[model samples]
Target: MGIFERYAPFVQDYIYRNRWENLRAIQVASANAIFNTDDNVLLSASTASGKTEAAFFPIITLFAENPPTSVGCLYIGPLKALINDQFMRLTDLCDQAGIPVWHWHGDVAQTHKSRLMKRPSGILQITPESLEALLLHKHAAIPKLFGDLRFVVIDEIHSLLRGDRGGQTLCLIERLGRLAGVNPRRIGLSATIGEPARTGELLSSGTGRRTIIPKIDAKGVKWRLSMEHFYMKEEDSESEAADIDALPVLEEKTDTAPANADPGLGYIFEHTAGKKCLVFSNSREECEAVTSTLRQYCELRNEPDRFLIHHGNLSSSYRETAEEVMKDDAQCMTTVTTSTLELGIDIGRLERAFQIDAPWTVSSFLQRMGRTGRRELPPEMWFVMREDEPDARALLPATIPWKLLQGIAIVQLYMEERWVEPPRLDRLPYSLLYHQTMATLASTGEMAPRNLAEKVLSLSYFHRVSQDDYKVLLKHLLKHEHLQKTEQGGLIIGLNGEKIINSYKFYGVFKENEEYTVRCETQELGTIVSPPPIGEKIAIAGHVWTVLDVDHKRHLVYCEQVKGKIPAYFGLCAGDLHTRIVQRMRGVLQEDRSYPYLMKNAVKRLETARIAARNGGMDVNPLVNLGGNMWCLTPWIGTYPFITLERILRLKCAESLGLRNLDTARPFYMQFNMDADEEGFFEILRAELAKDIEPLELIYPNELPLFHKYDEYLPPELVCKGFAHGVLDVEEVRNTVARWG
Candidate 1:
């Protein structure tokens, strides 16, 4: 039978109601893969291509013919927002077939979850962290809840592949399967993923099934892209050169945008007015700052506030308000957001997306750009790269306009190669190992050490962990009283460990800071780390708030709305860029090829940067001399390798080269004082790199907590080992230096 004919009656009715002239490529391919192959399936297609219905339609059809006694399908999402959105959509589709749909997340109501726990016979959608909680707290009820589970669908599967959270998800699935006594077929979904075959293997790991990735043709479509560079109107820049001149402005002139408004933000304000749009920032701090600045523009321009804020730090109410407002076709607004809104949320008819700075990865750029261009419009992205006007005496490193280069490189790499970053599947995830070990003991009550090792170590995600290293971890945990030994030579959670695993924060594998919830009277604004004292101002929710009182006991900050500007303190955001992107940045500077997406301001900025680089001889050599006994080296590599090289130069070759007072712009360039010249510097680096170097040599003695969340709890020896083996890329460092020859 044809794909549509194979669908159950309700699915057909829904399709007809939507007036789909035919099944999309993803839908047809998903049906064939699910029906013809016994293996797992990976569905990759463009956004708004009905990938959700594509996977659910075939699975729901089978459930109708022969519904399992327990929850038949498990859908795991990366975020609570996604589960909430998909729950409403999937509920409508499965309603007619008599299959109930349930969603479980922190924001979900307890009564809703209690209903599912009692009956437990339909589709249950949940986040990975919630699933982890279910596996632990409901250990006895697992068999009853999912004993007949047939399929496990991981949505936005690419988001989970690179970090400890992804490893935790894999371990949870395997642990759940063992408890429930059923090996469900896995289905992975994504709009932007790299190497489907390799990612497919990850999806099928521990499931005893290979993955079937259907090939689908992606049609060529035009994109609306423009990148502009700007310095704040109040600041002076060195761009007034003989060659650099602005072309005629293309964006609509904002006559009332305030004469002295920041140029980049003004451009965003001009375009986002009277439209449904998303302004994506790389960090929550940036998100808050952008939102607050844009709202001030509304006040200055005598216009209504047309912007909303969405991010992880925002309270559920605040974030949900943005989500709901964007869904209404009548509501014309823009959400200044972080990665929280970059994922697959079906905000209707988004007009355009504006990025304040370059995102860290191509995946993020694609995902943010993909949020728009739905509803028969092309995907549109406007990059507004802002930088402080460099001082005349500012070093060459500061004058090169790294953000502009990075942004151009991100676009060119994807446009030419059609490539995304491959998954870093190999990792010694000792932090996750520690977490899972504690969770297993707490859930199982008591287990022999050998059995515990077998259980935790056997997880496919822990393939890189060794038995000796596990033993070392156990010894450390015992010494620290995180794990207590029993009379029968078994292990259990110690009193100290109970303090950890007993809390909600323990469920997440990612690192987080202790934060206090901010409240204005009875309404909660969001969360902030290390709140300022009374009478101090903090920025959040697109406005400034002054701290009226601090409730340390309840971890709440009482505040009132106030006006002014201040950066929010949200801890640190780590960036790990790919090496190829850096290489492309170098290519952009050396080659004369122009990007059609570059706005006039960006074109002039690129020309000025190219002139500066050529005069400094940066086009030929990676090293440039700033002055006597001072030099800068552009590594042109990714984050990890850059870090590794920094350590190598400081620790290994510093004394020989008289390198001291080191400084870095990270992943772009490094500067330090050295006794040697350009040739001597290269010779010294080549000699140091040619030697037999151990990963441990690159690690600093004082930096143990730099690796992962649980590393500080581990023994220093094991922390060093994990940091060396997993975090450092010495081989890439060697290759980078070899290219210098």
Candidate 2:
């Protein structure tokens, strides 16, 4: 029978009601794989392409024919917002079939959870942290909750592949399978995953089943893409023969700029007016700033606020309000958001998306762009690249528009090579190992050290972690009282460890800061890190507020709405870009090829940068002479290798090359003063790499170098080992330098 014919009656009825032209190629392939094969399946397609239905239709059909006694399917999402969005989509599809679809997360109601606990059946959707909580708190109820689980579907799987959270998810799935005594088939979903075959192996890490990735024809997607550039100061526009004036001006670009107003934000405000859109920022701090600026625009125009803010720091009520308003077709508004809204949340007919700057990765760019084009319109994105004008005597690297080149490179890399960052599965993940060890002991109570070691180290995600290293960790933990030895040769949570495991915040594997809750009377406004003194102003939820009172003991700040602008502090947020993107960025500067998507300002900016790059011979040499003793080096590599080079220069080759006063711009370029010439600098680097150089040698003495959340708790030796082995790409750096000859 055809796949469509085999769908359950309710699925078929739903498809008919929605008036699908025919079963999409993805849906048909998903059905064939699920119905004919015993292996796990991966459904890869673009956003708004009915990928949800593709995977669920066949799984639901089987459930209807032979429903399991317990929950049949477990859908794991990276974000609570994604689960909440899918909850509505699945509810409508499963209602007619009398199948229950439940969501479990911190924000979910306790009554709904209690109902599922009493009679667990149908589908249960949850986040990884919630699942971790479930395994730790409800250890005895595992069998009753998911004993008959048949399928595990992970959405937006790409987002989970690069961090400790992803490793935690894999560990949870394996642990749950062992506890429930069931081996469920797995299904992975994503729109912007790079290497499907490799990622498929990760999705089925311990399932003992080969992954079946169906080959689907790439869909033709029309994008309404535009890019514009701006100088941070208005006076800079008139100084250097403005590139923006080289081409025909756009109505959006020609908008009058207020002397004190940010021109780029003004452009966004002007275009997003009277439309339902999403303004994406890379960080929570940037999200707050953008939202504040847009609201100020509304006030200046004598119009009511038309923007909302969403980020991880915001309270559930504040975030949910934005989600609800965006989902209402009648509500014409825009939300200034961070990666929290970049997931597959159904926000109902979004007209367009405005990205304040280029996202860190191609996957992020695709996800942000996918927010639009849900209702038969082409996916649209307006890229606004903003930077300060270079000084007249600025270094050569400073003259290049790095963001503009990076943005173009991201677009071209995807369009030309279909390149997206693959999974970084090589990390030792010692932090997660420490966390899992603690969690296993906490959940299982006291157990023999050997048995505890066997259980935690046996997890597939911990394969890279050695038994010797784990022993070292255990010894350190015992010495520090993070783990206590039992009276009968077993291990248990110690006093220090108990304090950590007992806290509600212990559930997450991501980094977090001690934040104070901002409140105005009874309504909670979100959170801010390190509140200022009383009477100072802070910005959040798109409005400025003055601190009326500070209760440090309770971690609460009582504030009232006020007018002004101030930067929000939410701790540090870092980005790890791929090396390919940086390499492509160099290519953008070296070549004269013009992109079709560049707006007037972007096109002019590219021309200017190319000219500057060629004039300084930066397109040919990696090192450029800034002046007498100072030089600039453009590594043109991603985060890991960039870090490796930085360390190598300082630790191994610095004294030989007489390197002094080294200043770095992260993954882009670095400037420093040296006694030797350009050739001498290269010679020192090459000779250093030729020797027996260990990555661990670059780590400074007594430096813990805490990168992950739980790294602070790990032994300094293990932290150094993890950073050297997992965090640095010394090999890539060596290879690049060798080729430099």
Candidate 3:
């Protein structure tokens, strides 16, 4: 039978009712493979390309023909918000066909879960962490819950492809299949997959099935993109030649709020008025600041606050309220959010997206931009690049508009070559290994240590883990009473292990906050971590505040609201600039090509930076003298290589070259004082680079660099090895030295 002919009557009716001219190419291809072949499927297409419908249509039709005895489909999502959004969508579609859809997450109602438990059927949407809890708490119900599971759909599969969370999801699927005695076909969905073949292999791991990636012949999409630069203050632009007045100033309507507020925030507020929009920031603190600033503007104009905030730290009620507001077709609201809203959460039709600054990777850029342009209208993004104008004596690196160049480079890279950041598979995931070992024992009740080791270590993510290394971990766990020898001579969860496993935090694989709630006179203003001493000033909710008192025991801080701006620091956030972007950033300095996205101020800034780079001989040499025996080195490599290069210079060549007071502005440039000439420095570096040294040579004997969260408990030797092999890009460092040669 043809693909559409294989569909049940209800699916056809829904398609016809929606006036879909024909099945999307992806849907047709997916149906043919799913119906005719028993192999897995990997559908990779752009946003709003009907990938979800493509995967589900075939499965639903098959279910209709042969209804299973229990819940027949398990849809896994990386984020709880994504699961909730998909749950509603799938429920709406399935209900019309008399099929039930149930979701299980922390935010989900217990009543709906009880209903599913009483009579499990249709589709069950869940997050990986929630799935872990289910397997732990309802161990015996596995068979009855998914006895005849036909499909396992993993949405946003790209997000999980890199980390142990992805590995955990795969392990859970395999374990569930083994326990339920049903091996379901797997289907993966993503909008930003870098290596299709590798990710396909990952999706079908242990399934003994090949994954079919449907080729999408989609036309190029038109983007309403623009990038503009702004200084924090007009007087700060003494060194920069960018004429602020030359930039196009979007005129504000009289009905809109005053323009004296933060011009960037004002622009966003005015543009987003009477429309649904998403204002994306890089961090939670930024999200809070943006939301609070926009609300303040609304209050100043006597306008209703149409702004809402969504992030990982916010309470469920607050996040859900923002999500629901965005979803409401009648309400005109905008949400200020972090990456929590960046995934495939269906928030109805959004007018546009605003990015506070450039994202770290092309994949992140695509995901954030994809949040808009849903339900038809083309995707649009306005990038607001904010920085303090460089001083007269500012160095070479400071003169360059890194964020603007980065934003342009991201767009051009994807536009010209369709390149996205690839999955990083080679990492020592010891932290996650610790998490899985505890979870596995907790789920399975008890098992012999040999059997336990065999099962957990056999997973593909653990292929690099040695038996000796695992034994060390086991010994440590035993010493700490996290695992104990049972009467049956097997390993079981011990006292400490029980405490770790029983907590809700154990469900998640990502880093978490030791969060403290922020309040002002009993009204909560969200959360902060490691609050300052009483009467100390802090910045949050877009304004400064002084802590009147602190309840450290209860993790609460009482602050009276104040004014003015201050940097809000919660934790460390690092950026991973791709090699291509850094190289293009160099091009931005070397070439005089003008980008259409650059506004007047940005264009002038670029011109000034290019002149500085040329005059400083940045194109001809990696190192330049900055007078008085001080020098600067520009090495435009990514993060890992940057780390390695810095260490190699300091440890191996610094003393011989008489280098001192070496400092860096990260992946961009390094400044130092050197007595020896540049040629002498190069000779030393080249000699060290030519030597075939062990990875351990990169670290000092006493150094125990703790990079990962759980590295503190690991043996120092293993930790160093992991850091050297997994974290440092030695090849890039070698190449940098070769350039000097």
Question: 1-741, model 2: which lDDT tens digit per residue?
Answer: 888889999999999999887988888899999999989998988888888999999999999999989999999999988998899999999999999999999999899999999999999999999998999999999999989999999999999999999999989999999999998999999998988998999988899999999888967887778778888674533211122213333234333324467868877776776789999888888888888887887777678888999999999999999999999989889999999999899898998888877899999999999999998887888888999889988878889998888898998999898889998899989999999999888988998889989999999999888889999999999998989997888899999999999987888899899999999999899999999999999999989999999999999999999898888879867788899999999999988778777766777889999999999888878898888898888888998999999999998888898889999988999999999997788888888888877889989767788988899999999999999989888899989887774
> How do these models rank on lDDT, best leading?
2, 1, 3
Tens-place lDDT per residue, model 1, 154-184, is 9999999889988899999899999999999
Compared with the true structure, the alpha-carbon lDDT of candidate 2 equals: 0.88
lDDT of 1: 0.88
Query: What lDDT tens digits, residue by residue, belong to model 3 across residues 295-403?
Result: 7788788888888888877666678888988889899888888889999998888878889878888888898889888787878788878777799898776777778
Q: Is candidate 1 or candidate 3 better by TM-score?
A: 1
Candidate 3: residue 245 lDDT (0-100): 23
Count residue pairs with overlapping backbones in model 2. Answer: 0
- True-vs-predicted CA distance for residue 215, candidate 3, Å: 1.4
Pitting candidate 2 against candidate 3, the one with the higher TM-score is 2
Give the TM-scores of the predictions, in the order they appear.
0.97, 0.97, 0.93
* Residue 717 local lDDT, model 2: 93
What ranking emerges by TM-score with the best candidate at the front?
1, 2, 3
Model 3: pairs clashing at backbone N, Cα or C within 3 Å: none
